[model samples]
Target: MNRRAFALTFGLGLAALASPQAAWAEDHLAEAVRHTKAAVDHGKQGQAEVLVTHAESALTHAEAAQKGVYNIHVEQGVSHLKAAIAEGKKSNAQGATEHAAEALTHLEAAKKK
Candidate 1:
């Protein structure tokens, strides 16, 4: 009975992994959006350090999304995200905010496709 149960569990896990059920591109895009929102909020409060953290996360997710399905908008978003990070690290809140917003716009457009 234990052996049977183990086999069943293993088989189910393999099947679940093989299934093309999840939308990976969408998931990555969603993560990017969430982090971008947080970054925007932090930027508004002039928290450049915190904003940079979220912007980095957003950039990671954006790059993941770009990998799943190549899109020009996603590529542009990655570029903007990089700029946001650079500006944030330099303690330039205004520049970071602008770049982060640009990244979001590109990400949103990519999400639609």
Candidate 2:
């Protein structure tokens, strides 16, 4: 095999290896966004307990998305989700709603990237 052919093969192999990880990250990020949106909706409805449930789910997926792919917006989104959960636990509907909204914004930004 020629050097050029070897280089091309190696590059393709690397790409193939990376594709799965990229797809996994995208899937997790999408889930996180979906859950965060739900949390925001529940928060708006003043359902603190329900908001907590969705926020926790969103947090799990957000953290998973961060495992191999680190984005600042996702990081911020995770933080907001945590805050939302905390406030929801305290039955602070307004606070939880605000935090969930913030999380949604950041998660959406991360998805765009």
Candidate 3:
């Protein structure tokens, strides 16, 4: 095999390996967005308990998405998720809803990035 061919093959292999990690991060980010939206919806319905559950899930996924990527939007979304969870635990539906809405916005931005 020629040097050029070998280099091309190696580059393609490396690219293939890197793509999976990118896809994994994207998948987790998408999941975080979905969960955050669910939390917002539940909070709107005054279901603090359910909102907390979804927010927790969103936080988990958001943290996972941050494993290999540093995104300010994801970080902000995580913060809002924490606040939402805390407010939900306190049965403050309004506060939780507001936080969840903020989280949704940040997560959506992160997705675009």
Candidate 1: Cα lDDT at 98: 88
Error (Å) of candidate 3 at residue 19 is 1.2
In model 3, which regions exceed 4 Å deviation? 1-13
Rate residue 30 of model 1 by lDDT. Answer: 88
* Prediction 1 TM-score vs. true: 0.80
Candidate 2, RMSD to the unseen true structure: 1.8
**lDDT against the true structure, each candidate:** 0.89, 0.93, 0.94
| 19-110: candidate 2 lDDT, tens digit per residue | 88878988999999999899988888999999999999999999999885899999999999999999999999899999999999999999
Which candidate comes out best when scored by TM-score? 2
TM-score winner between 2 and 3, please give it: 2
RMSD to the true structure for each prediction, in A, is 5.9, 1.8, 1.8
Q: For each candidate, give its TM-score against the true structure.
A: 0.80, 0.89, 0.88
Which candidate has the top score in lDDT? 3
Please give, for residues 14-108, the per-residue lDDT of candidate 1 as tens digits.
87864542368779888998898888888989999998999999999988887777889989989999999999999998889889989999898
Which stretches in model 2 have alpha-carbon errors above 4 Å? 1-10
Model 3's lDDT to the true fold?
Answer: 0.94
Q: If both were scored by lDDT, which would come out higher, candidate 1 or candidate 3? A: 3
Q: Candidate 2: lDDT over CA atoms?
A: 0.93
Of candidate 1, the 10-residue stretch with the lowest lDDT total is 17-26
